[model samples]
Target: MRYPANHVLGAQRNGVNHVSMNMGTVPPGGPVRGTNYPVYPDKLLDWYDSAGAGPMGMTSVRVMFTWEAVQAAANGPVPAPGANYANYWTDLVGVVTRCLARGMVVVLAPWQYNPASKNTDITYQGQPIQPAMFADFWAKLATAVNAATGNDQRVAFDLINEPHTDEESSLPGDIGISLDGWFTCAQAAITAIRSAGNANTVLVPGMTWTSAKAFTTNGSAAKWAALTDPLRNLGVTVHCYSGIDSPGSASPTVLPDACSALVQWARAAGAKVHVGEIAIDAGDNGFPPFGGTLALAQAQWANWQQFCLANDDVVIGWNWWGNSAAGWWNAGDSKHPQGHHWGLSLDDGATRTVYADLIAGSVRTPRLVLHDNLADPGTGENTTTSVAWESPDIWVRQWADGGVVAEPVQGGRSCTVYVRVTNRGTATWPATGTDVVTLHWAKASAGLSWPQPWGGADPALGGRIAADVPIPAPVAPGASTVLAIPWASPPNPLHYPDQDGHFCLLAAVTKAGQPWYDGFTGTNLNTNILRMSHVASRNIHVVPPGQNRFGSLVVENPHREPWRVALAFEPLDPWQQPLPSVQGRLVLRPPEHVLHRLRGMDNLTEAGPGRVALVEPGRGLQGLVLEPGERLAVPLEWEGEAAPALRAVAYDTETGPGTPTGGQTFVLGEVEGWTVEERAALV
Candidate 1:
């Protein structure tokens, strides 16, 4: 059905309300009764100002108007014009006006209900009113509210309140309306509302007290499916409360799968739905007021909140039942015997209940965290080896910003950066959406500003470029996944001479191409940025030789482009013999059968134990090329004197014979292989 055109919280509107009494008051310290204390005019305005529009921050209020409060005589027919049947309707109109003034939507739910004195005989003009009369009442009421509020779109109407097959036992149990009859009344009311020139939305409820179960089980679907609102503004109002009848039932209905399925069905039907009332039971639901724990209440509340958020597309919002000290808020307090401890705030009026902050905090925002180290989800630890099986002695720092600088950039080359990410917020990460990890070319150490290095650089990168790797899995709170981000260094490095031939590579987890909402603010970005230069790193470590004196040579490439370095050694002992000659192989392999190559590399390999040779990666039979962030290790052994001293050379293939990195010398200790004395000591 056609609903109000301008409402927030995605058409359904999140809201709460005062009880089902248009005008009345229960004693401040009174006994527990069904009737809501009639709200005085001043108190009505106070409630709207304090709870409705103030701390509670709800978007709408359902004003419960009774037939008795409108008609002068219970047995009288329609009152004549200018007759003294009802007062100016000042209290009712005033509440609606104030709510609208505060930008709160209003629903007029007039029931043939009058329980102030516990009387349930619903009659007018000395005769029992028929089911059709309920529709007539809504027509007149909608007309009155339309004129009173200038036909505002924020106002809506409900034909009847909680109509069922049998009258509640606590009341008079005089008027029993079946589900079919209720549907007829609803349709009649919608027609009458339109006839009165009031175009406000209509809230149609199902049998069984208008609950999700009612809509799903008790023939509600049949009735709803048959009824049609010509205006197309009809909506379903469902009430949800855990364990309402049984005070100590073992199993309480919390987040029922039926409720979720119902919303999906409503969405398919293009209908709006509102959770008109929801609360946790004191005894059956294991909540307070019946010696239960607050944890139970929190769980119940959280489940409902998550359900609403998850289905926000079709479900409008919800409203807690009552907000007064003399109502549901009572929790057996002597000062307010009628309270139920379900109030979002305390009865003292100003004191906020434990739920005040919780209600506000229920609204969620996205939070993303980019880990500094290569997180191993399998082991829950940072890997000492390079990602993609590249290096080990690279010494990349974990849990610290600016991990070890990666290989430097060659003028123009494609690079792959691996970073682990986690969602640390309350919301779930959508598998594929506007949220993604982006690469940027940042300035030296100042990572704040991201100026486009060139035109067509950023906007060109779109649609799951990084998800190709095994890192696109959706993550929940406290869960992590990896991202293999790619970036191609500027092809013409000479064009930016002022850039000092060095810059930083930054990877950001962004939402809609911007810093995510509710994420770390101000310079504390959830991203991975590492400073890199056009240089390579090499190291030689001496080991206690087993078969003979031996040492290892390690080379680390820190640039986006691939590199090859030739290795040679200076003997520590003049009589030491050379070790075996070993051939080196390329590091990163291209995708099988893929014609394109990423980060092209040069050629170099060890000629002999102490010699150097040259070859091209992907071209020669035996040659070594280091991919960006790749590390290579080579071991050498020799029969030498008591102690052997040696110097290793690791020169870039492009640097001819010159030692770009200072060749360092390392001394190796004597080989102490399994000897008789050592074996005996071990034993």
Candidate 2:
């Protein structure tokens, strides 16, 4: 099927904006799907039957073979024609014949990079091969393969893997070949192959590890394009790996700009485009930096497939770097022995991962998360004890200015609630009104119960501050959008003198067919917030410095049985710590003032001054109990100082408290004495 040049590949649903990918005229046949074969040909049938024949539905295979397998020596005294030569050549031919019989396109790639030799020259048995010798190897290999497969169009020859020069090497001590020298060998190989009367497709790769970005920018495009191909079936191949430029990044965001540039180069040069090697490490199983989540890694894989599908006109196909055999999965075809595992399956190919399903055309559902902190992965469960209430995802701003500032919710004044929703899934969430965010408010409490404490399902109960606020735009995969809901005249604590002026805010996102919970019954609030990404709460209060703020909160036992509870105070990090002057730079609070204390808890035995201080940061009060269906109103009196301060008051049911079930953060605003420049100098 052919698409028009201006055809739109993205569509919006229910007023949400979806990013459009401009598609040019699509090639006659859709792009072929494929994976790389192992260095040895023993597991060819096993891989072809599992991934290629089954749900993965791969239509091509890039067979990896070493130059030493075909030739015994570098220059002279090479093996005779059609000689097996250590049984490697015979095994490789059998592998190619089996692939062709299964109606699969076979791409032959030579694992020819020499690390010990200077200039990354093509080598045989750890010795650099001359340009003429390199050409002779391809000529003989092409002739033999053509004779075996009868010059089948389904067979293609990739010149070499990741040709690079000394200037292009990102590593030390290993000098690479000159670009001109590498091109001379490539041109010679092409000429020799055509002169041998083998008319199969020829695939040429660029320098700097054959990276797509380097192909266009590193002079590989013009040189490779200039090489003569009598059959006019030359294809340009490039490799793309996530975080290829930024080393050690677990889940770097992948974009289509490089792929688009590659397609443009191929179209302009009149060469077919193919991704010879491409794969991403699935960092889902407790991998460092990804935090054992599939959201980020899967999103990257989806982006890669989308790029290939959107540009099928110029891009002929892409071959994944591996199958799941243990030795080949991470070995990287003898080039880098310690390469990472980029396979789509695990457990010796018994377990098919998310990438396998994605290759079979499965679309992952949208996973929406409202992060509790910067370090919170969407799946982290109640792991943060003191900072649960200080979420970066939810904030309160002035209604008129829409300025995001650290301030309390002023009673009887207009304010806007800003909630950031991130989509971790591959599929975009439609802007349809069904995808809604609701904001609720309740009196600040240690243990908050749903319906009873949060004003039951009825709007008449007056718990909901904002209901059914639709996200203005569609959130694409790996994208975040902030929704603003204007709250006019929020509930005033002054009018209801019996209630404390402090309130807790809860924000939840609900969409049809997504996992959601209406209440936290069996589990604690923190655990629920951690497990469910769609919900988050804020119980932070901003108080002016140099003044005493009085408030009270209820400490209740939400469980059916009596429970012992412990409370403590902890200092916030420098970034989240409030400044003395909102305009001034932040400086670390003095160690003495780090314990921002709250007095007037007369019921607890350890309520006096200095006794109630946090015992060196995370340690707090212990050995207090509340019976089932009991609630205690604890009064708090805090005298604010002139210095900038921010602290969290956390309560937990465990003895040696870890991962607090509920908490409240207090932020102090600017004082009268400090100047902005003085604070800056101190910092």
Candidate 3:
């Protein structure tokens, strides 16, 4: 099985993105100091070896550099020993030599357009200029590198990283260039390289951040078609980011649409396409800053890899965006409170996440189709060869009295609706993480309108419930197992008509901790719902967890009655241990006639001795009256070594503690860091 001439799949070889990289005082910094954030070239190579990239069929490395780094002045003599560009040349050439030694194709990508950098300057010789000057700069550097390394055949050059139309006029210090100007400049650069006795491959890219959306709609086909490569060694590159279409919506479907179209356009233009930079925000990176689930991110990248493999002739390869700054992890900005995550391997260096694992899996298991469910087994159906966001086709089996049966019993009576699921796709159904069969309840609708996961639900019923029975250990390809939940219809009288009885029961395999809507296709959602025939009012209604500066908890109202209820909080450490006391420590001072205080903050009244007033309805005098569908909030202050769990309950002297409802058992603490203060700092 021979592949395309240069159709080798791989990743950005740089250990970290230059823009986010820690400079550590570059001019006077140590050789590899900045890259010490976690990795450098050697470390990255080690990761490749350990991750089995060679066996997985990956054969290239896209080395990134900046134009200014190589040729500070557009007309500066070829990169030499004592020039300002010396260290950059040395580092880049060392990477190329090392990659070539490993028999990997090297792609030299010099970025002339960078809006993220603090210094966004592109000049020629002594004056700021545009595309033509960029061509001159590349020509000089390409000539120098080729001469220095003997014009190695494995070497290729990516003209620029993610150029856009607006970039021409965005900068005031430089002359602007149109899209056609970029093509013309690229043509001149190629000619210069070939003219200087170098025939390395040249990679050209479309505008608009080199995006796929731009490739298809931004008159890219015409520009790409007009590009002239005398040596006939040319390729086009585009970036596919989920956020391109919507914020954090990178799914298995987005990339292929753009990739397929780009490949078609490239084939027409007598060139191949390479995904220059691809990234998606998996949920772990934090929602405010980045959206989407880790599973979706994995699926998107894997599908893109699969697409390249399926179309090896037209779509050459792709590179996971360069590793990001280590410091950014958990140092979330205004958008994401948990910090940022943009690296192949985490900052810790010890753990390579599912992203890396998926890349390796795609290489080793190229074109290994995995479907959630297939209509016909012998027919060998192939559904577009994309990643499975949600398994669509699940066979739901219902049984009665231990014998196999079809239809669930009707009428308002308690009956068993035993169910099990089978894996019909090419991919394995993971037993853990976000992949598991969960039971959810939704009001049944007329006709075939199944309930969407994000649709409305009664506040009485909490979030989707996990199966009472554990998912069978590793539901491999073509495997099936019973659900952990033993489905017993809620008990009711005959022909019950309330909302509870007029509902459908759903069993979905969702990415744990993420919304069910994350799946690419509806296949993961089995709409063959078990219709309910009974109705029963919830004795207690518990809402999802809410948080404050002190702690987090779930509130519940017992019986939905209009009676006022008094709530009490008894805080204990994670292990249910009492707060340790050091000779009645004075960590805080209470205002006169008040109970609790944290320095300049408002003072709080206590419920009693040793018990803080987390929630008081009327100056610690009256109870809160909660009506149906209404809830009350209790503010708590967590000042301890570990997160505390509170025994919280709405109380009524007539009903007693047993009758009152309890909040969520555990409350996570804000463990930012340790605090130590003087015992008597206040007068």
TM-score of each: 0.48, 0.44, 0.46
Native-to-model Cα distance after best TM-score fit, residue 261 in candidate 1, in Å = 4.2
Candidate 3, poorest ten consecutive residues by summed lDDT? 530-539
lDDT of 2 by residue, 386-407 (tens): 4556566677776646454545
Residue 638 miss distance in model 3 (angstroms): 99
The candidate maximizing lDDT is 2
Model 3 regions more than 4 Å off:
1-41, 49-58, 80-84, 113-128, 167-176, 243-251, 286-290, 324-341, 347-349, 364-683
Model 3 lDDT tens row, 1-683: 11212223211121222233222223322224244222244545545433433332335667665554555445665563353346556666776776666656677776443333332223232233555566667678777777767877667788766665545334444333457766777777777777777777788888766777668777777887777767567777777775434543654677786667777676555466767676556556534434667677677766665565445435556666555334534332223554343455544334555445556564322111112222212112223211111122211123344433222234334445333454433345443312444555433221112233224354233234334233564656555554434445543323322212223344544323433332122221222111010000111111112322332222333343565555444444433333443111112122332222221222243444444432321122234554644433333344434433333434454555433332222233331111111112110
lDDT of each: 0.46, 0.56, 0.45
What local lDDT score does residue 13 receive in model 2, on the 0 to 100 scale? 6
- The C-alpha local distance difference test score for the whole of candidate 1 amounts to 0.46
Q: By descending lDDT, how would the candidates be arranged? A: 2, 1, 3
Give the lDDT of residue 424 in candidate 3. Answer: 38
Clashes of 1: 31
